[model samples]
Target: MTQTARRDVDPSTGEAAPPAFESLDPRTGEVVGRHPIHDEADVAAVVREARQAQTAWAELGFAARKQHLDAWRRMLARRLDEIAGLVCAETGKPLDDAKLELVLVIDHLHWAAANAEKVLKRRKVPAGFLMANQAATVEYLPLGVVGVIGPWNYPVFTPMGSLAYALAAGNAVVFKPSELTPGVGAWLARSFAEAVPDHPVLHVVTGYGETGAALCTSGVDKVAFTGSTATGKRVMASCAQSLTPVLVECGGKDALIVDVDADLPAAAEAAVWGAMSNAGQTCIGVERVYVVDAVADRFLELVTERARKLRPGGEPNAHLGPITMASQVDVIRGHIDDALRGGGRAVVGGEHSVRPPFVEPVVLTDVAADSEAITEETFGPTIVVQRVRDADEGVAQANSSRYGLGGTVFSRSRGLELARRLRSGMVSVNSVISFAAVPALPFGGVGDSGFGRIHGADGLREFTRSQAVTRTRFAMPLNPMSFGRSKGTVRRLVRLVRLMRGR
Candidate 1:
């Protein structure tokens, strides 16, 4: 290609500037793909086009939608490796990790498609004795269009939670992927089009925060966002101008609590994997551990030993990949520095462990409850372990955060009880991040973790509106809703109410 053809020309200068922006492979900072820098106008145009496409897509009904979704699933399954390569290239996650995410996403797609009809179809309800002549029914109807702002972490799986459910519920989607992983987003939209070629039922608009803001106000029926808590607030604010409803899955400082009777080896392994996977960029990645004093020493020894063996690199066998967002390395280092300054000791990795694009797993102990590492989301492959006098203190410290997202508890007897007492939206007993793999469960959080669910029945309903219909089967003998009711009828109605009330 010619030099000018490879570059973006400035409209006013009539000279070649540079391509708007590029999606880079985090592992080596190599350009994966180039995309246009879409703005508000661009986002609005796509949303309008999606709105036009939604009419026919919605009319296709549940069975037809399911058929298309199933076709897409088959395509993904058949070409799993190809797509997983794209995921790894753009996000720098291990190939196996990318495949695992796609596997979970496929399961969710099947669940949403198979259950949409049952969950959203019209259902009849018995009318009350006083209104026995009326028939009442309720159903969920599709919103015209939904705009999804997806995060870089688990780009396919995370957004598909919104995308698949929204389409199954009879709505079109206009997605705005994180600029850091636009290639993955574009690949998904392309695959969907191959499954259903008639229209743009799923469209991806690529750019930065500005593009996401535009989507929030693009007149879509609802917005589904997954990102930092601070950015989620901004998205909500932008949607507020147009009075649009939104579902946000934001940041979390998720914790894992270990009881005195817990399985120390299994808990330690889970803690290492949960906290260090994806270079610790996971929204639900474990960031803290509250262990009972009785077994704290053993637990720490096991976790530290496993954590030290992990290394972040571009190799195929590497346990973790580079940090997808380059800027986040600084944030991770800052949290580590703060933890150390607050009198915490790093048992595994420390300040010297963080290098550009990679951060070794760092385990801190004795971190104060008020320390930034404990209070705020570090979003790195770092875990802080604290010794608690008992399970009560462990639970109390775990619930002290403003974030109430996903958490884990390891206990033989008190797992369920302690899980119920924890303040998070979802928790796993003796397992780490297992709740996200189950397609039947609703996934979301409260407090700083954000609100509204994105999986299971609630997720399907999030993209639709509930509609109630009441029809008069016959004229009532005592019609309270009629203006032509006689005094005798009113007197009888009062008598019936009084008799029912035992007056």
Candidate 2:
């Protein structure tokens, strides 16, 4: 195939020519599989099918929806390995990490299904005495269609946070998986179809950025996007054309804080795993570390040693896999070079060895807080360590970024207090990224990290609309809303207000 043709091939009619997207081993550039996809028109056809399916799916009531979700959950659990391999093949992450992603997704799936009805159920609202004869209630209804634009890293877990919740809340989904890992998305949709066999409630579309843009403008009710902040803005703008709501799970320059009273070994281990796991492709990964002055050198030494042990390669048993997307290698290398040129010293694997796309894990100390490596989201197995005078300084520096997705704090005596002070959606105390496993907690961020949530009760509400209903069962002698109210009624209203206020 021609290089340009090999890059992408859109379908001509409703049927596609063949697989257009190819998964490659970053280390050797060997093709793993060619992911075929239908054309843009076919994508629209899928959305239309989903729209048709949603009418009946939404009417299935919370119990029916939960049953469908539970069936799919069982199927996913039974074939976890098969799905995990697809993730490993496409994103080039270690098999264990891929399995970890699937494990986390199961928790979210279960929570969303079990809690959707309670979170979206209708409840009575108290009306004042004047309207006491009327009944008022509020409920949440599905928004019909939800479009999800997912990222490649942590593909299953990350996007499922939004996808599973949206589904449980009774909305049909049209997911546009990242071009890098289309097969994983396809597999997920196929699995869901097997469980629900009656309709195409969950559909998958594979393409590049253009496909995502088409989804935003393709009349879906909402778009849940997880990618870079720059691209998030564009997605928001495109959605604005139709005033479509979006939940953006964008990039994060998360931080880890170590207090003077922290267990040095435990804190260092958390920092290393937070920054180097999944080759540091996590949106919530710890990109920066702030250690108290008292144990700065000790913590850095321990973390550097641990990071050195996690090397990126294409082998099945490698600790870290090659950079999933080739473009990320350049970004990782650039950040390391910038940090080095800007007065940072590398304590461990800072340079790439002889590998096609595998970049070594990098650990740097004395990096300027204002340097690109410290300030930006490098999305690589690189850590920038800085010494803070105290825990207060660590908190301030951690909240300095525009992004606030995830954070970590390690303190033997003050884990909870410090975890609360960190400005992020969820923080791990003493450990790293454990908040994702606890499906009861909401996951998302404030500011540039985007709004709305994707877990717990908050996530269920994001996919449904609040519906308020009021009905009068009896007549009020002094009807304030009616023009027949007398002067005596106004006086009575004022007296009632004064009595209620205890004035």
- Every model's TM-score: 0.95, 0.95
lDDT of 2 by residue, 1-503 (tens): 11112533345665445546665655566676666555667677878889999999999999998999999999999999999988888878889889988988987899899999888989988986757898999999999999999998888998898899999999999999987877889899999989989857999988778888889888899999999999999999999999999998888999999999999998898888888888888888989999999999888889877877776778766888888777777788888888888899999866553144676788898988788898889998889999999998999999999889999999988889988988898899989988888888988987788878888898888888999899989887777776778868888887888888756
Q: How accurate is candidate 2 locally (lDDT)?
A: 0.86
**Consecutive 10-residue window with the lowest summed lDDT within model 2:** 1-10
Candidate 1: C-alpha RMSD after superposition: 3.0
lDDT of 1 at 72: 93
